[model samples]
Target: MSEKQAKKERTRKRLTQEEKAKIKQVEETHRLEARALRENWLNLDNAALIYPAIGSTEWNSVFRLSAIISEKVNCDLLEQALRDTLKRYPFFNVSLCDGLFWHYFQTLSTAPKVELETNYPCRPFTFNRKNQIFRVLYLDNKISFETFHSLTDGGGAMRFFNTLLARYFELTGVKYKNLGDFDLNVRDLPVEEESEDAFHRFANNGKCKPRKETTAYAIKGALENPNILNVVLGSVNIDALKECAKTYGATVNEFLSAVYLSVMIAEKHHSNTKNRHPVKLSVPVSLRRFYPTKTMRNFSQYLNYEVPTDRENASFSELIEIIKAQSKNINIDYFQQMFNANIRSERNFFVRILPLAVKDPILKFVYNRVGERLFTSTLSNLGICKLPAELDDKILNYHFILGATKLNRINLTAVTFKDKCCLTFSTRLSERRVIREFFKMLTSFNLNVEIISNV
Candidate 1:
């Protein structure tokens, strides 16, 4: 390569921060203020009903959202930034109150403190008595936000984290002219849209589809410190993953889901489990993609794809085929059916008339027998995180970790940024067979897989 040609290539690749700011100017225009309203006692949305009934010290239904920035975290600045961010997102700063018939939310008068994290990810929320549903942690150069599932899902959590980052940057004198979705200054309004219950908005009084229950293959091994969470983060090259998925004619999620199912089947065969059942993967489908709403609450549903264990020897292509077809069918109509099912149950006269004490155990029983038994595990992909050029350069990467459940010991989540797709596995059981075989399969596909474990 000639020096002149090399110089030209280098110049094109290294974009100045100012140039980065100008590149995404059009996206900055999409930012608009939202109209917000204050409410003391608000009803739980359709999706949040089951969480409280089944929640315990062990299965708290919480998740953690963390970011790796270029500079060290400043606690003072983060504290103030959170105070300001909560003003705009008041729905998150509330405590759960038990009602006669339902669990309601009451806005807290005081704000929760931001502390440095010294514990494992997805710690049980009941361990603290502050009554706040979410808490922020700072360590080294990272900022972590942990929240109960009843408060929100991944989409809402991302909004809060992004907004907090933007405000922190401003406080540190590093101003971002426009951070795209990460721009905190642009969405500075108390908009009702932010707190809207989207499931209620898109549901109807249609006959709910009766869900069929089937036993799925469960992973069993030494429980080992059952309370401890085993985390393995695999950073895969996005370009290579995309190319591999392209050849299979599947999305990244579909391809990874297939890969995950393959690992589970292989482990089952290795263990020589006598009775085999259908292997089901619980995939969360975000409702915001279909119906437009800015509600920062739980507005997502799960789509379970089951492959019979008798067909454990099926080719990767065959497993992916089933996944692609099932995932594609989860369209607007499918979501409506799911939303209506829950709404129908909530609207039932007998169910509504039942006392809270009577309803809790019934809901818990149904969840254990049907809900928890329906799927083998969960694979949730948060799509991709895109930020303005300057901010993107400053961020090392982002992670999404779902809390492990009593029935479902392992849960996997993926989020992409720039060229890296971070796939995180959170589990409670001692067996590393599933996670070990998962990355091995990725390497078999000739994709570069880097593993980082927080055990």
Candidate 2:
């Protein structure tokens, strides 16, 4: 070794007395602060309050965000990246803890384990003791993040995932020129607004009227084993899909929602079960654009597009027109009302004082009887995802997959990256007819589609 290198190693190995004392002091202070955090608890946001009460051993609201990197992932580097990423999102380093009247979050004593992917995606958290609500898994070149819905909505999860990718890319020495455009740096510290309950912040002052929910027609099929999750991904050119949507005089989201409703109608017709109810697609709209916030938690609401029973036989163009008419709800005021309705209930004296034992069963029953029944299926489009220019070809693809619930046997999610739009369908139904029909609709437009599956 060179003389300069040998001297530097010697200095690192043998710290001076002053340096040692300063290091010890810093360590002690950090230890105390961490200890204090371990004892403290955080309240579940207005939307997340029901998850702890309603989540079951069989099913829970889980969502996954994944990216297939161009090269095989280095496990050691991915682990290091996770540790560094959590520092800027301390809220993610937490466990769901049960309390007397409500459930809460507590920072974990240590970080969560990063493991190799083996089991099905979005497996239920045992929640035996201090289990974190989120998990990170890597297999081959793909890095997948699965989290309980209570943890964060798509906007929050995307930021966290993108930040981790930025750090991972930096570690791999690939610098992206457009990295500053999004400004999601892993080196930054946590800010107060990142953990704020934005639902409460943007709620309207007046008692907003909550819209009546429809008891929509449900997707029926032979159930697959509860232990398994089936995911089918269909990829198409974003430009081609957009052109098709444009052909129908519809936006991408409206076009997709219309296609989903058409599938539900066809399913009903083929089954002949005589379910003539409205087929509703629960479309989750991110509130970040309307009510800006930096909170890394759930802050999105659903816009139900219920197909009018009278117009059930309408052509695809007619369905698109129907959806376009309902697009009026895509506004600040509509979401404000949705937010207000939930926040007001949370503020109710009775709900606030109820015991956990009494609240849990009631919440579960209400969720099953109301929430699940109000929507036939869900269609969430993450608009368009942008990454740094250098990372354009570095990421092979992206997928946004939702977990299976008992009522909604199949759900669809879409995400676009670098002009490639991936439409992922996750389901527990062994029946693949609906999936086939959905893709058939796409191909009928002469759009070339490549399919992938983990059935």
Candidate 3:
């Protein structure tokens, strides 16, 4: 090789080693506490006791970053700044291991071995060659910021994006005024207090076995020309939606729930069932509301509401009233029961000691069979997103994605953008047609709706 080529190769090797050393330093500084480990185990294993089951195929979180820099952007400087920022926040650098039995922290040398992509349609939990649980992908300006959901949830990945963007600006000769204030305290959040009354009520109520499947009608349709569609979200003035709810004595959630369920019932013709079984709607209630905790790991609960099929034939006004009544009954007491039941199951020493590999398959089977029988679909309303008023003049829009649980056959994710609310419905490939038809009916009601898809 030429003298210049040999010198370039030597420089490259030195940089690689330096990067590895940096990663190791960060990992060594943030050792996991015993309480944190126990909490992590409970979240990974016990939470599967309720809701939909999670397995190796659906257990991991994914992160991806794509940048659209100005034409004058220096790629090398931008990359260096990102590396420095990641070295400061190493939690994003680790992954789970031993079939979710432990978290195998990654060193700089080990990080490069993790896979940047996966073949699964839904993000599955898996360990990388480095024995880490998460992976990151870096792309150029070819992809849009909107494409991030193909990997991880909004909550898990957004902070990393903000950090990357801030660093990029610094690399391009721009001074970041608030860089010192960007520190995040993931560990300082308060622990949730358990309610004894709630636990007692739950124990007395007995365990709820999966309900038998009802005879509700299922809707079907086909997209004439399916493609990944752009979503142009417009705010619905929260006051307007709230006023609509107040007129019918309903809360904002109940009002939206009624509208969504009405669309489903109209499309499915659920009223025709011989036994008049109710159409169920699954709502994900954030545990943060009932419990005062902010652990970044999985911390959410769900409640199911079965809307009477007869409401499909009622006037819209009447349906909204019924939904309001149902929602008002949901309170701290209800969540307490859920928490107590979950803890009761996890407290079983024998079950707690069972290896995750053995427990996972059995849990998966029961969850898929039992969960589907209880609910028709899921609704996750993340409410208003908390972002800075100004993000380099690019306003952050709404966030939504499909749930990855094994029994989560369909999910409707809603978030407020500016003043309007944007809702996205995600279903199995088999049920995509049903979702499309529901959106079509929503548009026909004069509701400004848009469709976004990965097709």
Best by lDDT: 2
TM-score of each: 0.89, 0.92, 0.65
| Candidate 3 TM-score versus the reference | 0.65
The lDDT ranking, best first, is 2, 1, 3
Reference-based TM-score, model 1 = 0.89
Candidate 1 vs candidate 3: the lDDT winner is 1
Candidate 1 C-alpha lDDT tens digits along 363-399: 9998888887888899998888876665765679888
What tens digits encode model 3's per-residue C-alpha lDDT throughout 1-455?
A: 99999998888677877787887777765555433533342223234233222444434222222333334344465456546544544444443434453222333322322122223223444444343343333333211122112122343344455555565555555654445455332222223322112222234444433434453333333322121222222234566666767777777787777776776676466334444446677787765556543333334556776677656577777777776677778786766666656666566687667776666666667665664556667676777644333334333344455434334345566776566566765544344544665565545545555444544
TM-score-wise, the better of 2 and 3 is 2
Better of 1 and 3 by TM-score: 1
Clashing residue pairs in candidate 2 are: none
Off by over 4 Å in 2: 1-31, 176-178
Q: Which residue pairs show collisions in model 3?
A: 57-124, 59-125, 60-125, 95-133, 96-133, 235-419, 235-420, 236-420
lDDT of each: 0.83, 0.87, 0.49
What is the lDDT for 385 in model 3? 48
Listed per candidate, the RMSD to the true structure in angstroms reads 15.6, 5.9, 8.5
